[model samples]
Target: MPTRRRTLLLIAAALGLPRAGAAPEGGYRFQRGLMGTRFMVTCYHEEGELVGKAVAAAFAEADRINEAASDYIADSELLSIGKVPPGTPVRVSPLLFGLLEEAWAQAEKTGGLFDPTVGPLTRLWRESRRRKALPDAATLAKAKAAIGWKKLVLDPAESTATFTVPDMRLDLGGIAKGQAADRMLAILGKHGVPCSSVTAGGDVRMGDPPPGKEGWNIGVRNRDVDRNAAELVLRNKAVSTSGDLRQFIEIGGVRYSHIVDPATGLGLTRPVSATIIAVNAATSDALATACCIADRETGRKLAAAQGAEVFLAEG
Candidate 1:
């Protein structure tokens, strides 16, 4: 698998001091490296010790999810699946099975715009970026041949997945971080942390507003201006962004984003960034990717269908 890419979104810290009764002393914040990116959790709780334990649990949950889904991990379930013979069903853990199901559904919903089967394309681009050159037409063709969500077979009942085409690979990098953030928030909730937020890189998931605030304030970065374009007050929601600004390769005076178009085996060129706010981090993350691959109108329609809002920045 290709080396992991940097988180594509930037989230500004909430501005201002916590309101009265936010926590006994103040909200506790914790950050750690997980899933090849920084995962942070902030919680409001009466007991500092409880907050610590809850944060630890949340991070642990994130790590567990990452271990199961990360394609960069050599022994990860995702990589193990790729190692299996084509057309041979390989049973996966419950977590991976569930995620695979969700990914397939999202891929279908977006007409394959958001596909986990783009691993081959991702690797090709990564190599091209490393070499400071574009992949040759033959190599690009081979990579494209290995991409197709329809070619991946999933058996939910048996918790098994298979690739119809040889050398096909799956990469959950597009959606796993968002799912991990959501799972971390769930772990925090299970520990009785009522108001909290978990950010797995760019995918931010919040349970509720702080003790006295209407909603958590989040900043959406504008790469063209190198400033925050807008700050959104959100509660019980998730936001994610996909862009080429920070993670891209320049070749022959043209910029190629890390966000690849699986359909064409090429990186997006026009849209500099795409952001989405939705009811869940996973959906928001997948939709953000879909927005990057689609035209503005089509992207907006996709987000609207899911009761989410999308912002696309183009040159």
Candidate 2:
């Protein structure tokens, strides 16, 4: 549950696009702390009360999804599955089961570049970061042994999941927030709020453009420049970026990113940042994590294969 913080930088307002509908007197924006980060929802509506109700409903949906997916929460459905004995099938909620299935598929697709089973390794790295030292070889080996998507079995019909190895754990941090954003947008849509945007950490999901604007311009922050590295226009699309610039540890004069490589059970060393733009935030979020682990060419190819655009910054 102690995941790396996102380097979102900024979500800029609409640029010089023409307003399409009757320009609302003003837009409504709300921000809340959720999922260990800031969640903001913005809508263009004539009535403040309507926007407020839609924002509340959207956030409530986000809360529900986060509770089910969060590993930090002891009673979360995900942790409940972690407590089950090896090879014991446990029925899970539709959301958890679907996410696990998606995680498995992505793990296979990316050659384990993005893995939910890396929770043990993630914990090891967190402790290593805390101690300001690298994890010993023996400890890394033990954690690595408990990781592998192939070791997890899912029964779709029964909606049951079983881990083949004892103590195997799952972490959805990479994709959960994006998934929550996607769901939040759906909730807003259900409330008849057509033009809106929801930002959960670095993952962003936007609906139609505000009034007459062509699209929302999301600024990608460049830590080195202390300004936006670039801007992406988004409408009915999502963007996610992953990097170690903001969340990492220094040990023995070397910097280790919080984004770990499951294969080596070690944090990434390259000064690389990957941004993925896809149809949904979940895909963008998970693929961005994959890009962090993959080589430059491989990451680009993977992103392209998914019909997503990728931008990688290597320093």
- Quick one: best lDDT, which candidate? 1
TM-score (C-alpha) between model 1 and the true structure: 0.90
lDDT of each candidate versus the true structure: 0.82, 0.82
Off by over 4 Å in 2: 1-25, 222-225
lDDT of 1 at 104: 90
Assess every candidate by TM-score.
0.90, 0.90
lDDT, candidate 1, 281-306, per-residue tens: 99999999999889889999999988
* Residue 119, candidate 1: alpha-carbon lDDT: 96
Q: C-alpha displacement of 85 in model 1, angstroms?
A: 1.9
lDDT of 2 by residue, 1-315 (tens): 111111011112122111122222356666777888888877776654455567667777788888888888889999788787798898999988988888788888888899988889888887998889998888888899999988888999999989999779888888889889998898888888879988898899999889879999898863454877888778999999889878899899988999999878999888889888999998999999999899999999999988999988888
